[model samples]
Each structure stands twice: as C-alpha cells, then as structure tokens.
Target: MEKTFTEEQRNFKELAIEFARRELNPGSRERERRGEFSEAGWQKCAAFGIPGITMPQEYGGLGLDTMTCIATMEGLGYACRDSGLIFSLNSHIWTCESPINKFGSESQKRKYLPGLISGSLKGGHAMTEPDAGSDAFSMRCRAEKKGSHYVLNGSKTFITNAPIADLLLVFAVTDKGKGFAGVSAFIVERGFPGFSTGSALEMMGLKTCPLGEVFLQDCEVPEENRLGQEGAGAAIFNSEMEWERSCLFAAHLGAMEKILESCIAYARERRQFGKAIGKNQSVSHKIADMKVRIELSRLMLHKVAGLKGAGKRAPLESAMAKLFISESYVQIATDALQIHGAYGYSAEYEFERNLRDAIAGKIYSGTSEIQRNIIATFLGL
Candidate 1:
C-alpha cells in the first residue's frame, strides 16, 4: 500500500497527521466531557482542506481521488483523538456534500458545493426517522408538491450535525404508491419555514459531535432544491451509502492503528510478576491480535477504496468491508481495554472512550447485521 500511494497522497497523509495532532487533539477530552461540538476545530479542518479531499477544485475542493481521501482520513484517525469531530466531518462530506455533487443539477452544485467544501456551511442528512433506521426507505416523512414549493412533514431522529447544520439533505416520500421508488430528496436550508432541530441528544460515544432530531412540519422547500429527479431518492441514498461504507471506515483503521500502538507501549512498560507484562502470553497474544486485526482491516479498506477509485459500484465488497472493519474495531477496542485492565476501564485513559466510540461504528452506516444481509443477498441466498 505504501508503494502504491501517489507522492501527493503520501504527502497529504503525513501533513494530515501533523495537522490533526497539532490542531484537533487539544481539549478533546473536555469537549467529549461537555458533549460540545468544536466549531473551531471544524474551521481548522476546513482551512486545512479536509472537507474537500475528493471534491472538484472548481467547487473549492481538492479534486483528489478516492484513495487519497481514504489515506488522508486514515491519518486523521491515527492522530485525532476526537472521534466525534471526525464523525461529523464524514457525515458532512459523504452524506451531504457527496450526494449533492453526484446527483444535484449544475445549478444546485454551484449553489451548495462551494460553501459546503469551504467549511462555511455545515451539512447533514435526515434519512433515519424514528421508525426507519435499517429500513430507511420506509421513511414516514412526506413532501407534497404545491405550486413553486414542496411542503414537507415528518421528523428525523439521530441526525448528525443537526443542531449546527446550515443545510440538510432531507429524504421524503413524494408518492407513496410507488414505495421506495416514490422517495425523493431535497436540499433544505436552515431558514426554511417549519424546519427546526431538536435539542441535542446525549449518547454513550461521539459526544463531541452534536446529534439531534430534525422536524419538518409543513416545511416549505423551493422546487429548485429538489435533488435529482422526483423519484431518485432511493438511488441517491444508495450511492451515498456506498461511498460512506467504502470510505468512512478508513478512520477506524487509523484509530485501530493508534489503539494497537498504545496497547503495545503499555504492555512493554508495565511490570508484572517478573518483568514486562508483554512477556506474558495472554497479554502479548492480545497485542498480537490487535496487529492482526489492523492489517486485515487495512487490506479490506484498501480493496473497497480501490474499487471505488476505479469508478465501480462495489455493493458486495463494500458490505463485506464495512462488516469486517466495524466488527474488528469493536473487538480491537475490547482487547485494548482488557490489556490495560483497571486503567483501561478508568476514564483517565482513552480506552473506555475508544470502546464507546467503536461500538457506534457497528450501529452506524448500517449495522453489522444489515451488512451481513446485504452480502447474503449478493450471494443470491
């Protein structure tokens, strides 16, 4: 992988690591404790061009390839301890910015992409309603056309960046008779009538990023804001999911790399019965397993990223990758906590927080079960 990277990617990765360590890591524990969103960190990341890694240069993006994006994000994960901020950044780029870039009309792209990529605007999507998580297409949100506007009604929960987002990619049922095909997506501005965000919901992890509900009660959206065609929401959603599942997990690979290193250092330095605890088979084997998981995770991430970079749809490969990497992260986090014993459980070290954050990876993007189902369907099972 090192040999395969372009010189630009290598340089970008190194710089991203340095930038994140210097700018994003400070006060992370305090932000996490307060469940505060880092506006300053967000701007710093924007100024550093983290949000525009794969966007077109014309639209204020880096115009880099998918591999470069993943490599840079992996570096971000390795150096940045603030997982919530990273999560929010990924949601902004993959769900909000990427979908608009791919499916929006030229006018819409010109209107939204620059601000989104430039970091002046924060964006997230409202797809998971209270009843429509894994079954996202079953959304109860409805958008009815009325002259020059569409009136939207329904609520979306567990929305990332909701509390602070300037724009949102909202999906709704435009024609219930057509089922999933009836779904449509719309770009909703924060100032739109009847569109409001709920108070932030506390979570076990990723607390530094705001999460909340989006309520659309007769929210009036301009016709020009509709993304793609009238019934293209399902396709738009699937595309975003593919990109997200393929790319967002790169951060996890970086994180696992960090966790592995910490575990090794602790195992080597901590004394036990005779010498370093690393000499014990139990402790040493766990650290060895961490390395194994990280390498395998890296291979899977690279494979999916390669497929995406080649302009291919990799539903099967991406599902396999998401399932493996997410589950592997949880296991790695568990082993890391175990390796540190009492210290790991304590908040003084980040192991407990890392575990909390890792658990969410399994639930988001699609649960481990959902990924298995996707892979099974691909197998014609």
Candidate 2:
C-alpha cells in the first residue's frame, strides 16, 4: 500500500538520513572497539532536533507527529552503522522524553524538558531490577514519603546510559500493600544525595552505548519530581513500553534493509563455482525472502505508527509489531549471513554485530515471549 507524507516530513527524513551518515558514521568501528558511547554524536543529534521530534514546539522540540518521528528514526538506522548510538538515542527519545513531555506538569516540563531537548541532560528509565526484568510490576525498589521528599531505596540493573545519565526515572513501590497500583515514578538526578552509579557492564553488542547499575540508598527525591500520580507508575511504564514497542524497532527495520542490500550485492558479485552466487536458487530465494520480510515488518510498523499518530491506544498493534519485527529482524540477519557464508561470520563485516544486536531486541522492550502473552490475551486465547 502507498502512503503519503507531508513535504515537511520528507524533509525531516532527508535531514536525518544525511546527518546520520555524515555525522554519526565516523569511527563507529573504532568507538565500538573501545566500548565508547557516542556522547558527541548524541549531542549532534540533539542539536539536529532529534530529541524533540515528538515534543511540543514551545519546549524546544520539533513537535513532529508520530509518523514523521518514525520515518526519521528509520532513516537514522538506515544511514548510521553505530547501532549502540542508535539504541541510546531511541531509548532517550521514546522512553524518557516522550513520557515526560506527555505526563510532566508545566513546571516539571519547564525544569527538565529544555535541558533534555538541548542535549545538556541525558535521561533513561529504570523499571527493571535484578528480579524484575520481564515482570516490571514486581520490582523490589521502593520509595517512601518523608515529609517534603520521597526516600528511594533499592537498585536497578542493566540501565541504559546509567553510567553517564544526568536524569533517571526510577520506578519503585510506594505502598507495596496495594501491589501494582502502589508503584510510582520519581525523577532522580545524578547529584542527588545517596544516589550512586556503578561501573559499566558490557555486552556482546551495542558496546558503544554503556549500561550500568544504579543504587539508591535512602535517596531523597523532591516531592515535585514525582511524575504523574503516585500510583500511576505502572501506567507510565506500560505507556513507555507501548511506545518503545511501536517505534524502537524502526532502527532494526533500517538495519534489515541495509543487510538485504548488502546480501544482494554480495551475491551478485561473489562468484560460486562458475557464475555469480545470486544465480543459484538458494541465494536468490534468500534475497527474495529478505525483501519479503522487510516489507512485512514495514507494514506492521507503519500500522502502529499511524495509530499512534492519530492519538489512538494501540497496545495490541504495538505488541504485534514488536513481536513480528523483532523476530523477523533476527531471521533477516541470519539469512543475510547465510547468503554471505564465511564473510558474514567474520568480525570485519557489520552483519556479525547486527546479529548480536538483533538478539537483544527479542529480549528488551517486552521480550518476544511477553509479547506473545500480551497478544494472546488480546485474542482471548
């Protein structure tokens, strides 16, 4: 199906593609080798108006609609090979900025939105704990009210940008006797007393975007820093995951497209036996299947984007999109690698890193298993 885009949206896509290639593409391999986060590239993107894509224009954001935001993100993934940088940027935009822009009060927005939009402050959400990866509502971190402030305790693990984040949205139980409804969100700053960060914990892929543990030992968060209603933490967390499920995989889509193109080129040029490898039925079928997978993923993603643009609740669509796209991305990457043979397994090629990164996609933002459970409930199955 053909979809129309506004002239402005088209311009946004072009700018994102060009800027990502020219600015975010430099030294990606070397930076990943050193396990470096692209702080400089992050600033460049913020200056380029990425952090504010879905924010209100008054708050120093571009105020782009959901579709435009999706298009720009997909463009960035297409042009930028620094998967870690892309991951960091997406988490910032969708998880942290989007929620604050929607739920933060005028005063709260005034205090944090500008700096976040301006790239002066980095932000990430902390919902998962040591025992609560997929079961977010079961988090053990707690926050207790103490007169003028809330005292936060417990720790969060595998928090993105944790090592260098200036701001964090920590979700903890305020009244555990009430279960899920007792959960609440607090905005904790780096310099806050009793708030500490641990050393970075590395992974197989996305080394450029650092992850670490956050510790809060009676950390006092100001009353004003509480996001939304005290018991609405689960709501906020669910909404953030909904947005992440719908939009976070736009990068994966772009990466899959790139992999498809690379596989085609490799098959066309790499001779097997007497002729180009693409002439073989196996190679051609893989390329065709890759194309099919990309189109399917694109359609599913666009469906979620369109619903979100119309200010619709798309929890079902979001779950389905994330489930299909994340799984398809792994398959597409595998097929691309299979088509490339030894070259795909070699570290010199970007395909290997993409495969590693794609594995994490199935695990994060509601794992594939969790997605299935959500979808099953939606179907009354």
Candidate 3:
C-alpha cells in the first residue's frame, strides 16, 4: 500500500536515509561482530535529532508528529544495517525518554531532557528483573519511603543500555499489598549512591546494545524525582509499552525491505545451472513471498501510526503490528539466507547477521506468544 505522506514527512525520510547511509551503514557489521557500542554514532544521531524526533522543541527535540517519526525511522532502517544501534535508540527514546517527557516535572525535564536529546546522556529503562521476564510486574524490588527520600533496593536484569546509561527509569514496589498498583517510577541517575550496573550480558543479536543488570542497594532518590504519582509505575510502564510496541519495529520494517532488495539482486545476478537463479521458479517464488510480507507488514505499521496520530487507543492494532512485523522479519531473513545458499551461512556475509538480529524482534517489546495472547483477549476470548 502506498502512503500519502506530507512533504515535510517525505523530507524527513530523505534526511534520515542520507544520515543512515553516511553514519550508520559503514562498520555496522564490524561493530556488531565486536560487540562494540558506537558512542560516536550515538552522538551523530543525536546531532541529527534522532533521539528527539517525537519530543517537543522546548525540551531539545524536533517535535515531529507520529507519522513523521515513523517515516524517518523506516528510512533509517532501510539505509542502516546496525540493528543493535537502532534497537538501543528505540529503547532509549520510547521506554526512557518518553516517560520522562510525559511524567517528569518541569525541573526534571529541564535537568535531563536536554542532555538526553543531545546524546550527551544516555538513558535506560529498568523494569525487567531476574524473576520477571514476561511477568514484568512481578518484580521483587522494593522502594521504602523515608522522609524526603525513598530508599530503593532491587536489581533489574535484561536492562538495555544499563552499562552506559547516564539515567535510568526504574520501577519498584512501594506497597506490595496493592500488587501492580503498588509500583512507582523514579528517575535514577548513574552516579547516585549505591546505584551500580552489573556486567553486560551476551545475547544472540543486538550484542552491542548493552543489556545488563542495574542494582540499587539502598539507593536514595529525592521525592521530587518520582516520575508520576505514587503507585503509578505500572500505568506509566503500560503507556510506554503501548507506544513502544507500536513503533519499535519501524526499523525492522525497513530492514525487511532492504533484505528483499538484496535477495532480489542476488537472485538476478547469481548463476545457477547455467542460468541466473531468478530464472528458477523456486527462487523467484521466495523473492515474491518476501515482497508480499514486506508490503503486508508496512500496511499494518501504517495503520498503527495512523491510529496513534489520531489519538485513538491502539493496543490491539499495535500488538498485531508488532507480532506480524517481527515474524515477517524472521521469515524474510530466513528466505534471504536461503537465497544466498551456502554464502548466507557464513559470517562473512551480512545475511547471517540479519537473521540473528531478526530472531530477537520476535522476543523483545513483547513476545510473539504474548502478542497473540493480547490479540486473543481483545477479541473477547
């Protein structure tokens, strides 16, 4: 489906593509292989206003609309091969930056948003705990209120950008008796006393994204640092997820298009049995299926964007988009690998890396199974 984007949106996409080609495309594979986080790349992206795409200009952001942001991200995915970097950026903006923008007080925003938007300060979300993976709300961490400050004692695992994060949006239980509602969100700075990051954890893909544990050993945060009202952590978290699940896959959608182009180019150029592989029906059909998936995923993503821009609740649409786009990415990667035959299996080619990275999409944001459950529940199951 062809989208009718405004001239400004189109311009944003072009700018994003040019930026990705110049900045992110080169050395992406090497960085992924070495598990090296690109501080330079982050700075470049910040200069390009990527971290502040959806933020208001008053707080050092571009303040682009949802559709423009989606278009720009899609362009970035199309031109950039650094899936890890893209994932890290999304986690920072959606999970960390958005919460602070929406819930932070005037002083908090003044203190953090500028640095965050300028890439001088990297942020992370700390919600997932060792015991809470799919059940993120079942965390055992506690924040005890004492006079003017809250003493936090907990450890969060699988935290993206933990090792390099300057600021973290952490959630802890303030009153366990209230279950999910008992949780609260706080802006914890890196140098806060008793706040520390654990060693980075190795992962299948997004290796350079720096997943790790954030430990709070009686970490004290002023009452003013609380993100929202007391016991509003779960609500804030869910709201952030709604935005995250809807748009986090924007880059992956572009990646699917990139893989499709690569597969098609390979099929037409590679000789097999005295003829190009594109001459073979099997090879041609795989390419066709990849195109189909890319188009379908794009349509779903566009629908989600439209819903969000219109201020409508898109829990169902976002879940469907996330599940479909993630699974489609994995399929496209697999097909691209198969099209490359033996070469695809080798680390020398980018197809294998794409496959490895694609696999993570199915698990993060929300697992495919979890998305399915959400869809089923929404359908009155």
Task: Give per-model CA RMSD.
Answer: 1.1, 1.4, 1.4
- How do the candidates rank by lDDT, highest first? 1, 3, 2
Please, what is the TM-score per model?
0.98, 0.97, 0.97
Report, for all candidates in order, the number of backbone clashes: 0, 0, 0
Model 3: residue 295 alpha-carbon error in angstroms: 1.4
Off by over 4 Å in 2: 1-4
Which is superior by lDDT, 2 or 3? 3
Query: In candidate 1, residue 190 scores what lDDT?
Result: 96
Residue 379's lDDT in candidate 1 = 82
Kindly indicate the candidate among 2 and 3 with the higher TM-score.
2
lDDT (C-alpha) at residue 358 in model 3? 88
Q: Residue by residue across 100-187, what tens digits does model 1's lDDT show? A: 9999899999999999998999999999999999999888999999999999999999999999999999999999999989999999
lDDT of each: 0.92, 0.87, 0.88
Model 2 worst lDDT window (10 residues) = 1-10
Q: Over 4 Å off in model 3, which ranges?
A: none
Model 2 C-alpha lDDT per residue in residues 255-328, reported as the tens digit of each score: 88788889988999999799999999988998998888889888989888888889888899999999999998
TM-score of model 2 vs. true structure: 0.97
Task: Name the candidate that leads on TM-score.
Answer: 1
TM-score of 3: 0.97
